[model samples]
Structure formats: C-alpha cells, structure tokens
Target: MFKIKHVLLLSFTIIALTIAGCKSQFEKIRLSNDVAKKYQEAMKLYNKKNYSKAIILFEDLSQKYRGRAEAEDLNYYYALTLYKLKDYTTARYQFKSFADTYPTSKYAEECRYLGAYCYYLESPKSSLDQTNTKAAIDALQLFINFYPKSERVADASKYIAALRLKLETKAFDNAKLYYDLGGFEVSNYKSAVIALKNAQIDFPDIKYAEEMDLLIVRSQYNYAKNSIEIRQEDRYNEAITYADEFMESYPQSKMLDQAKALKADSESGIEHAKRMIAEFQKNQEKYKAMLAKEAKADSTNTTIKTPIK
Candidate 1:
C-alpha cells in the first residue's frame, strides 16, 4: 500500500507541474514583444483547434503585423479565428474587411462568401424581425454576381432562396393578421384586401398564393357587406370583380365553392341596393308633386278671396 501511494503522489505532482508549465509558457508568450513568435504560436494553436486561445493571440498579432507584407495573411487568419470561435458578427466584419483589402488574394473569394454566410447564420426565426435575413439574401446575391464561377455559388443561391422564403412567410403572416383582425374598430377587412394584394405583388410565387387569393375575395365580400347602403353597390361590385379574378387564377382551388358563393351574394346585394335607390327616387318625385299641388290650391283660394280690382 505504501508503494502504491508513493507512485500515485509522484503522478499527481507530475500532472500539476505539466499544467503549471503550460500556463507559464502561455503567459510568457502572451507578454512577449516577439511578433513573429506570437504569429507562429497562434497558427499552431489554430491548427490544434484550440480556438479560444488562438483567437486572442491572432487578435494581438493582427495589430502588430498591420501595414507589413504579412498584413494580408495575418488579417485572413484573424478573421478565420473569429469564425472558428463562432463570433459570427465580428467574423463577418473582419472577413469583409479582409476581402476588400486583399481583393486579389487567393483567399478573397472565400472571405467574401464567409462574410455573407455569417449574415445567414445570424438570421432570426420566422416570427422575429427579418432584417438579418434580408441582409443575407442581398449579400449572397452580390457574392454570386461577383463570383459566378465560384464553387460556393451553388450554396449561395440555396441560402438566398431560403432567406427569400422567410421574407415571403413574414409578409404572408402580416397580411393574414390583417385578415384576422377584420371588422375591428377600423375597417380591417379593407385593410386585409390591400395587404393581401400587396403581398401577392411582392411575392408572386408565394406558396400561399391560392390561400391569399381566397382571403382577398372573402375580405372584399365582408367589406362590401358591412358598408353603408350608399357605398354598398360599388363595393359589392368590387367584390364580384375580385371573385372573378380569383376563379380565373385558381380554377381548381379548394376554396372555389366559397369564392363562387361570395360572388353570388355580392351580386344579390348589388341588385338589392339598386332597387332601394330606385324606390327612394320614386318617393322623392311623389313628394315634389304633392308640394306643387298644395301651392296651386293656395294661389286659387287667394285669387278667389281678393276683390275684383
């Protein structure tokens, strides 16, 4: 037991010494003024995949080596280190800077792609703000335009499509919100109609095109139905027009029956409004004729009562 304990103690001492020695070496290198040595060590750490330590050293060497011939290489590695560390926002800026400063470098094309990819990585979920998603699409498209033959072009195109789809989803949801809020304090049905129309114009090939078309028809119908009698005729006619367009566009849509039903209702409402207007005009003419008859009677009485002067 004594022999075994002695061996264990020696092993523990050696492990502690090794750890202390490594920390000491790192500290020494960190405080050293030797830029070349720091660059070499940073590269070594990066190769070992110790990115936490590597990034710090690379950041330091990046400044020390600025404006020198090694600047390009140093900046490239520094940006890569940040990427490997998963500091995507900083990585994006650094990579873009590297690409701009060394446009002719072999790494320039890759850096540009990485910078755009960082924006893609930063994109939020569909329900959240999509500013980063839009930025990603723009950046990726620009990258594709700049490097048509790049091996990464295919990937960039794929990401662009995904980001565009996200935008389409956001627009669709926003328009649907208007539809859901129909008949609120404001004339939200009309708002829904406008929103859906704008969404369709913005995303012509949206997946929900059929659904949106149906919503527009429904919204128009509701808007016309709730409008004051004076406005109902024109509004219902507008609804019928929207229904016609919907039927023509999506002949086989599952909502075809509903859309047709709305059209029929709108037509009925228009005819009813016309009849009401005609009845109102007839009553108004009768009122004017009664007034004329009363005036004539009053004049006859006054002439008969007056002396033959």
Candidate 2:
C-alpha cells in the first residue's frame, strides 16, 4: 500500500509540472513586448503545423507589427493560417485583403488565386442554389484577366469551365421541369418552350442542346393540339413550321421520326379544318335557294286566287 501510494504521488507531480510548464511558456509569449521574439515564435508554431496556436499569436501581432519590414510576411502567414484551418470564408477575405494591400509583393499573385479558390471550395452541390458557384466563376475569371500570363491561368480557366457547366445544368433542369409540368393546372407547354429557348440562347454549347430542341418541337405540338377549333389551324401551322425547322437542323437526329409525325398531324389538321368550313358554307347556300323557291310559289298562288275573285 505504501509503495503504491508513493508511485501515485510521483505521477501526479509530473502531470502538474508538465501543465505548469506549458502555461508558463504561453504566458511568457503572450506578455512579452519583444516583437522579434514574438514573430520568431509565431513562425515556429506555423512551421510545426501548430496552426491554431500560430493564429492566436499572428492575430495579436498583426496590428502591432503594421508598417514594420516584417508586416508583409506576417500578413501572408496569417491569411495562410486561416486557409490551412479551412476557415474558408474568413480566409478568402484575408487573402483578398493581403493581395490588395500588397499588390507588388511576391505573394500577391498566389494570394489572389487562393482567394478565388476559396470560393470554389465553398460552392454548394448542384441541387442547391448556385450563387456561390457564380461568384467563384466571376472571381476566377477576374483573376485570369488580371494575370493573363500567370502560371495559374490554366487552372483558373479549367475551374471557370466547370462552374459554367454547373450553371448550364441548373438551367437545363429547370426548363425540363416546366416541360414536365405541362397539362397540369395550366398549359405549361408554352412556358416550356420559352424556357428552353432561353436556355439554348444562354448556353449555346450546352450538352443538352439536342434534347432541348427536340423538347421545343414537342411542346409546340402539344400547345397547338390543345387550342380551340377556330384557333387550331393557325396554331397547328406554327407547329408544322417548328417541326420543319427541327428537321432541317438535325436531319440525322434520333427524334427525327417523331418530329416528322408531328408535322404530318398538323398538316392533316389544317386540311380537315378547311374541308369542314367549305361543307358548312355549301349547306347554307342550298338552304337559302330552297327558301327563295318557296316564297315565289306562295306569291303565284295568291295572285291566281285574287284574279278569280
């Protein structure tokens, strides 16, 4: 029992001493006004990958070391520390500030690139709102334009392509949603056409270009077929025109047969409407002639009866 108690006491003393030493070292650095020692210690922590402790010291020294020869390096490291900690929003701001404040510094180009990259990292998934994705593209483009000859230009261009594709996907999906919503509470076919046309214009090189064009043809057909009889001829004629355009644009398309069928249906509809109008007019003419004959016969009979009287 005595031996066990002695060992337990020794272990507790060692733990206490270790904690005290750490506290003492932290206090010494925190209370010291020696800027050189503080700067050295901060770098030491940074190099050791103790970024959390390094950030505290760097934050304390940032304002204090302003205008000093070491200020640029200090600011660069401070921003870098934030980035390494994955505090991307703050890191982005700090990096941007570092670039603006020291445009001529050797670290300026890297800082600018990193600032834009932080936004890229923060971009949400494709299903979410793409505001951050757009911002990232804009920032990256600005970086590319500003540093056209930069070694990082290729990377910036690649990222811009990726972000633009995301926007393209979002637009395509939204337009498709309108198409799917057709024949519900409203005739959304027209809306689908408008949306798809806009998407085609906005993203001319989108991967969904072929699919969108086919959908436009389908939407126009549905819109025309659902109209009233009086308006059917004109609307169907428009559908025919769109179908013809699609054929001319993509003769080898897999949807070519479907587009042609729509054209044939529109043509048949127009012909049927014309025949109905012609038959109705012919019947009205015949009925009017018969009424004229009956009136003539009645007049003749009245004249003959009066003469006899």
Candidate 3:
C-alpha cells in the first residue's frame, strides 16, 4: 500500500512540473528579444488554438515589425487572434486597419469581410440600441458592393436581411409602446397611428404586418372617440377608412371581428357628431335672433326720448 501511494504522489508531481515548464517556456518567448523566434512561437501557439498566449505574443510582434514586410502577416494574424478570443470590438478595428493599410495584399478582401462580420457579431438585442445593427448592415452592404461577384456576397446579403429584421422588430415594439400608453394621454392614440403607419412603410414585408394593421384600426378608433365634437366626424371617417382597409386586407384574420366592430362604432360616432353639430347651429341662430330683438327695443326707446328735445 505504501508503494502504491508513493507512485501516485510521484505521478501528480510530474504532471504539475510539466505544466509549470510549459508556462515558463511561453513566458521566456514572450519576454525574449529575438523577434524571429517570438514570431515563430506565436504562430505555433495560434495553430495550436492557444489564443490567450498567442494574442500576447502577436501584439508585441505587431509593434516590433511595424512598416516592415513582416508587419502585414503579423497584423492579419493579430486580428485573427483577437477574433478567436471573442474580442469582436477590437477585432473589427484591427481587421479594418489591416485592410486599409494593405489594400493590395492578398488577404485584403478576407480582412474586409471579417471586419464586417465582427460588427454583425456585436449587434445587440432588439430591445437595446440599434446603432451596431445599422452599422453592420452598412458594412456588409459595402462588402457586397465592393465584391459583387465574390462567393461571400450571398452571406453578406443574408446577414443584412437578419439585421433588417431586428430593426423591424425594434420599430414594431416602439410603435406598440405608444399604443400601450394611449390610456395615459388620448393624443398617444394619434401618435400610435402615425408610428405604426411609418413602420408599415419602412418594413413593407415585416413579420408583424398583420398585428400592425389591426393596431392602426384600433388606434384610429380611439383617437376619434376622444376628439372634440367638431373634429369627431372627420376623425371617425378616417377610422372607418382604416378599418375598412384592414378588413379587406386581412379577410380571414383572427382580429377581423375587432376591426369590424371599430368600423361600426366609427359610423355611429359620425352620425352622433352630425346630430350634435346640427343642434349647436340651431341654438346659435336662436341666440342671434334674441340679440337682434333687444337691440331694436333699445333703438325705439332712444328715438322717443330724442323727439321731445
């Protein structure tokens, strides 16, 4: 039993020593003044998929070899190392710089594509700011335009479509937010109508198109309902128009019943507004007649008082 225990202890010690030796060797290469040796060892580490140490060595080599012929390959490898480390933000800048500095290099096209792809990787969720998403779309489109016949054009187009869909989702959510706030301020209903319409225009093939149409109808109805009597008829007429269009477009929609109800309510509201306007005009004529009669009586009294003088 003692012999077996000693063997186990010796095995663990040997394994630990080997790991320490490997780490020391890497540190020696990192701190060494031999630029060629460092560059060779960095390539070995990268090929072995040891990015953490490879990136350190590559970064140093980039500065040591600047403006030299070796710098071109060093910069490309550095950018790739950063990408493998999942440092997309830094990777994108390095890739773009490499392409700009070495426009005639054989790797220029590849670096440009990688830079644009890095932006795609950095795109945030739909609920977050979409600046990165827009930038990604622009970068990818530029790649396609620069290399129209390249094999990567198809991939670039696909990424642009995905980014556009994300933007569409954000727009849909924003317009729906106004609708959700409609109860707090009646004017929000009008804002929702305008926003949703704009979304439809921006994303003609949007996935949420059906939902947006229904929301437009509902928003117009509520907007008309909250308007003043004099403006109600025109607003309700607009509501009816939107509802009619929704029903025609989505004949088999689950929201068809809701759209139909809005149309009926808008028609009823228009009739009510017309009746109120007629009654208001009739009362206004009566008021004017009363004022005229009072003025005539005062004039007759003034004439009689002046005749004696």
- lDDT (C-alpha, whole model) for all candidates: 0.91, 0.89, 0.94
Query: For each candidate, what TM-score against the reference?
Result: 0.84, 0.80, 0.85
Query: Which regions of candidate 1 fall more than 4 Å away from where they truly are?
Result: 1-13, 271-309
The deviation in Å at residue 32 for candidate 1 is: 1.1
**Residue range 168-208, candidate 3, lDDT tens digits:** 99999999999999999999999999999999898899999
Instruction: Encode model 1's per-residue lDDT on 141-252: one tens digit a residue.
Output: 9899999999899999999988888988999899888878876834888998899889889998888898888888888888888877788999998999999999998898
Clashes of each: 0, 0, 0
Better of 1 and 3 by lDDT: 3
Model 3 Cα shift for residue 18 (angstroms): 2.0
Best candidate (score: TM-score): 3
RMSD, model 3, all Cα superposed?
4.2
Who is ahead in TM-score, 1 or 2? 1
